[model samples]
Target: MTDSESVRQDTHPSGTWDDIKELPPSAKLVAKVLEHNEAMTQQTIAEETLLPDRTVRYALNRLDEKNTISSSFSVMDARRQLYTLDINP
Candidate 1:
């Protein structure tokens, strides 16, 4: 959600949290994971969104291909991923 939209949701309880249901299936799931937690790996996306890991991986790959988001990995756990919205893109 945008800053203004979040502010509006804060003031109102008109299905604000249901924004996830309004998104395109894949983006919707990704949005939910990002909203609740800090950074998310494909694993986190799978667990949080109830999407299969392969599905999450594909969606994330598509997001990257479109330059819609960015990701990195933790040094301690190379498999642990971190994602960030690519506002500049």
Candidate 2:
């Protein structure tokens, strides 16, 4: 499809995340944040990516469930969870 056609076909504002443009809107937002940063807490990603905390949480959870990335808490904040791309154990 042409760029304009794609625009018409696309359902949401896009390119917020390079790896996520083709993903569903919510997933796209989260993917963008992950792609742009080495790692990010779910909350920080929620803020930077302009998605709700629950949405960010859900997306992160899905990516983790898929084994696309791994997650752990920061040394400083047990409450803060960081997600990083999974290249293998």
Candidate 3:
């Protein structure tokens, strides 16, 4: 990879961790859950984390604001968005 690309990759995890550290506890829990799983819908995340749906939604918004997580519409369920970690944990 190019030097810039290498540097970006090397620093991304630490940067992401720093951002995550500033987030609320609920957002941190959501990040942890995404770290362990491949990808999950908000409902699935709520179930896995045992958090309320509203809390999960709030956490997701926080994570998204930090660019620590990415989401895409699920193929099987258009209404559901699958969330995944954008950084390595």
Candidate 4:
């Protein structure tokens, strides 16, 4: 398997990506960005994925519904929230 595949498997032995497979393409993209970056705000995710803010927000909501990602208010900026993968990819 490729390195990315290995990482995906490592993220969740049962297969987090497998769970994500049914989600929207935008959600998958957002998950990938979070996997690589570890943690970031919605704006950063949008910048990294080159997706619009609304699209990113929608993706985040989808991920949230699946319990795939976690978020906490940024210590430096309470108005912003830092998002991270709950699955540890």
Candidate 5:
């Protein structure tokens, strides 16, 4: 196999983490938190990461743009959204 392909496989087995690894610090932090937890809201992420609400929002956007994360309306509060890593990627 080609060296580049080998490197890709070695670095990003899921292809999801590799893309997230390239994102900004806040995005990476959010991804890591989600990696451990089943799911969390934007507020929960902000509290867990100790990042500002705005930063958390921005990070979530970045993750969404890369298709690394997915969101669904919260069952507890439809106004709130729950975010989780896209395992299929």
Candidate 6:
């Protein structure tokens, strides 16, 4: 399998500690929130985590860069996006 596939198969909400160990505190916090909750929008995340919108946005960007999360346009609101962990494991 390719490297990306390998990483996916080895990661999940419950199994992402290792994968996120090197990430910053904000990223880790964002990841944990995603782990416990289902798909969430950036605003929802900020509310739930009590983090600033800018911080949450930065964390989400970091997670996205790490291939640890994925996002899709929200069905309820076309202008908003829903985020979820890329946990296949």
Indicate the worst ten consecutive residues by lDDT in candidate 1.
Answer: 5-14
Clashes of 3: 0
What TM-score, computed on C-alpha atoms, does each candidate reach?
A: 0.60, 0.64, 0.80, 0.79, 0.79, 0.77
lDDT string for model 6 (1-89, tens) is: 11222212133343345677788899999998988876788999999999999999999988877778877766556677778777546
- Which residue pairs show collisions in model 2? 17-32
Pairing residues by index, what is the TM-score of model 4?
A: 0.79
Q: Which is the leading candidate under lDDT?
A: 3
Cα error, candidate 2, residue 45 (Å)? 0.5
RMSD of 4: 8.2
Local distance difference test, each candidate: 0.56, 0.57, 0.77, 0.75, 0.74, 0.75
**Runs in model 4 lying further than 4 Å from the true structure:** 1-15
TM-score, structure 3 vs. true: 0.80
- Considering lDDT, which of the candidate structures 4 and 5 is the better prediction for this target? 4
- Give the candidate order by descending lDDT: 3, 4, 6, 5, 2, 1
Specify the highest-TM-score model's number. 3
Listed per candidate, the RMSD to the true structure in angstroms reads 10.7, 14.4, 8.0, 8.2, 11.6, 8.0
Candidate 1 Cα errors over 4 Å, as ranges: 1-24
lDDT of 5 by residue, 1-89 (tens): 11221111111122367787779999998998988887788999999999999999999999888877767766556677777777454
Candidate 4, residues 12-68: lDDT per residue as tens digits?
222366678899999999998888876688999999999999999999999887778
The backbone clash count of each candidate, in order, is 0, 1, 0, 0, 0, 0
User: For residues 1-89, what per-residue lDDT tens digits would candidate 2 score against the true structure?
Assistant: 11221111112222222333344667656765676677677778888888888888888766554445556656665555676554332
Q: lDDT per residue, candidate 1, 1-89, as tens digits?
A: 22222211112122233333434578756755665665666776788888888888777665555555556655546556576444331
Query: Model 3, range 65-84, lDDT digits (tens) per residue?
Result: 88887776666656767777
Residue 51, candidate 3: C-alpha displacement in angstroms: 0.5
